[model samples]
Target: MSTSNEPVSFPAGLEGVYVCNTTLSEVEGLEGRLIFNGFNAIDLAETRTFEEVWFVLREGRLPSQSELSTFVSQVEALSHLTLDEYKLVKKLRGGEPMSAFRSSLSAVANGRGFKSWMNRDKAVVAEEIMTLCALTPEIMEVLHTGRKPKLKAGNRGYADRYLWGILGKQPAEADLRALETYLILTVDHGLNASTFSSRVTVSTGADVGAALTAAVGTLSGPLHGGAPGPVLDMFDSIASVANVSNWVAEKMAAGHLFMGFGHRVYRTDDPRSLCLKRVAERQASPRIELAKAAEAEILAALAAKQQAKALAQNVPVRTLRVNVEFWTAVVLEHVGIPRTLFSSTFCASRMIGWGEHIREQIAGNKLYRPRSYYTGSKP
Candidate 1:
């Protein structure tokens, strides 16, 4: 009984809808700002652990000492994968590491106990966070190295323990801290494309696992959250300080968008990138000098080339100023994680925010079926 001629009112630009709202996070896309539980993302990136950030996103506040201990214990307890789960991850490979990770997560969630565990309200959020944080290393290990990794038990920071368990070796404390900061910075960012996709899936009554899986798929697109690796690759190709300007100019001449140069939001510098750059500087890897030089040259070239480019200063440049991507690449590289794993790591961290948004959508009980104005075949 659907009428093709019925005057279907649309929102023109997909503007107003209470599709989802999360108290844990908000993004002012116009201003390029990200906040988590009333705290600026930069503050969390500088001062908090990944677990602390996760606690804030799920429970609405940074955890106290005792709460942090309890949360860490819970997370550590859920870090291990069963024999069958490990086997399954080992079986799913030969493509993009992020894609493999997403597929593994989906398959593991379909295992018998996963559904029951995910459905429990008292521990659902914490459980989901643990699964995401833990499974990432497992999936990465299986895909990149083609080996089953042994779980390590000890008193290490979450990021340290994660990299250690995956790579089967202890990471330097500085590297672990840098990775932790990266995770904290990336944890949540308003209702971004991927987060919205997660909310949409959850609105259909899908469990947290399915919603997170959907979010990962959305993030795999280059336009969304898939640029970090390419950013590093660009830096590598530029190679030295002197070639930076020429390299950028050449890429622009060829009609290629510079990866990690400008952001869709943020008229000013990205605050998160600023904080990350600080971490990168402190880490002080060899690539730091090269990265900084390239960044400076790129900015100079951008300013000279186009007034409207907005590329003279942005998050990526700020990150390069601090050598953020270089340091991240260095640390991750040292830990045996391939460049391809960067996006997967991003997805792993952002899953916390996605889950929070999904819960918000379910609570609001609204379907996000936005209508569009008819612009085709009206016969």
Candidate 2:
């Protein structure tokens, strides 16, 4: 018997349900696993460039040297944003940086070539990836600097060249390598909240541009992609080596969740953090030591306070511990990008993954609507 007043129960955890068929990537959260189109991400991070990862995400296989060359050529060609689009990004300032970037993406999607490009079939996903790879940097530049960036001439591959063009000069090899690694690491992560939002938006038949815009909006939230930039800010606030432990304790007492400490999925340390930290170590910067000390104190305190709170220091702290952000900050700072631009740079990297996921969603064509057992209705 069912009645309006009957009580119901909604599932607290979606343990097993076929919510969607996402070939763009898979994440085994409990096991702390991440894979992009069947390749181990850690292995790929060590061996491949961001462009190569992008190819795997979109094409379901890696690019051969000849294929990579052609892909690089196409990506390099798409780096310039049209004049009208640039104007729109310049006008999107004065609010939150992520919001401004998201708005800028929405504006770009409404422009010519967006609609037709996004809805193409799987066979043309490669072309769509090329278009997106090109547009992302321009969008990021306008959002960060509030000005149109000049594109550099010559073929330097997409990640380095796009960042070089945005920064108005070529990056040093180390700087370019850091940016590439960050991009590859961020390219995909299982069914994170933001990625799920992207899948849901695309499932409704939204254009790929629209889906990506929605995903960016999700990523802008503090709980999602917005934490990394602030992790650096936390480091800056701590200031001196002596204040590290006290500062962490004060922040924790104030009920502020440490920006770079734990993750929802990874019970152990985040694999990506390990790789980024190693890169930062090899780079041999001063900030790495500061980050390492900060991380040590924070972890010790967390363990002392709650025995069960032992989520092995996640990527954010590991990243900060090794001063990954500091190294990146130095490079980007030298190139004239402001501190405010860090998150936008992050967005630029993640956009590749977002587009790939959207293409995968479109290919699988499953409505991502998940059912919840009614908790309010009478039964």
Candidate 3:
């Protein structure tokens, strides 16, 4: 151990670090498992609504029927923007969707103006966070259109409300189920980049708005939340099953990373991808066949590339496989979500997670101030 003031060193990007404990979710990379608050996330995606999973993540257990009803009602009550907030989205309409969402949400959450959420009760802060999560789709709607879009019916749930608002029509029930599944599967995934950013922000006693805003900005980074749209673009470029191999070969020869073919965490098929594949199948999307074919070609290409090269036994090969973005692109596109709004839609679900973690951060309250390795000219 360095007895002096030299900072402790860690792997760049802090890979394999365990920073804190949480009851929110566990991502088992080796097993390709994702558990949310002790429930299997795949099962939740199959059987739950946006409201139910949001409840489970924040409340740490499945709600009783009456409890779920109460929670749904509560979310519904919170699912509105003030008139001024509605007007705010009009001004932000032509801007980038995620940027618009971040700014507008921060504005709404700090309506009383920039008070530290640390001063409030944990329950109140959690409530405010929930209010923001609930309000997000409404804000997204007005951002898409330069006017306040109408809701489908009273408290239709997050996916329903969002699908209708964006498409301006009631989507098929199956489609609604598909989008909800995507939202549930993605709501939390341990201390991912954006979630970590949120916790760090709130750990410093920032307002909940500021914490969530920081998370949105972090998520906007392509390495974090910008794969789905490009995944769709790749499939469109491939055009047909027969084109997949040559297309993949050309791209790989040019040193392009396959957008949806691997993951940083999962060595096997991403469980979220598996779930979304099912959703895409159920939707009968025209794009899924091309995506699957392209994925197979890409995987074979990756494996062949690895086998052709010499490697040490200790070397970790890319686990060439489909990830969540592979089918996320298919399902979201089939469900009528615009390509430009892909990341924004991701943020909508992830809002649940950021809220849950930000609350957890403030409840225990430790500021995040990591020391850096000094490799520059000695001071």
Best model per TM-score: 3
Per-residue lDDT of candidate 2, residues 224-247 (tens digit): 666656776777899878999789
Evaluate all candidate structures by whole-model CA lDDT and list the values in order: 0.69, 0.69, 0.85
The local lDDT score (0 to 100) that residue 222 gets in candidate 3 is 91
Please give the ranking of all candidate structures by lDDT, highest first, separated by commas: 3, 2, 1
Ordered by TM-score, highest first, the candidates read: 3, 1, 2
In model 1, residue pairs whose N, Cα or C atoms come closer than 3 Å (at least 3 residues apart or on different chains), thus clashing, are none
* Selected candidate, larger TM-score, 1 vs 3: 3
Against the true structure, candidate 1 reaches a TM-score of 0.84
- My TM-score estimates for the predictions, one after another, are 0.84, 0.84, 0.95
* Candidate 1 ranges with C-alpha deviation above 4 Å: 1-18, 28-33, 113-133, 155-157, 308-336
Clash count, predicted structure 1: 0
Candidate 2, position 177, lDDT: 77
Clashes of each: 0, 4, 0
TM-score, predicted candidate 2 vs. hidden true structure:
0.84
- Segments in model 2 whose C-alpha atoms lie over 4 Å from true places: 1-7, 12-18, 28-33, 116-129, 252-255, 308-337, 371-379
lDDT of candidate model 1 versus the reference: 0.69
Once fitted onto the true fold, the runs of candidate 3 whose alpha carbons sit more than 4 angstroms away are: 1-9, 310-317
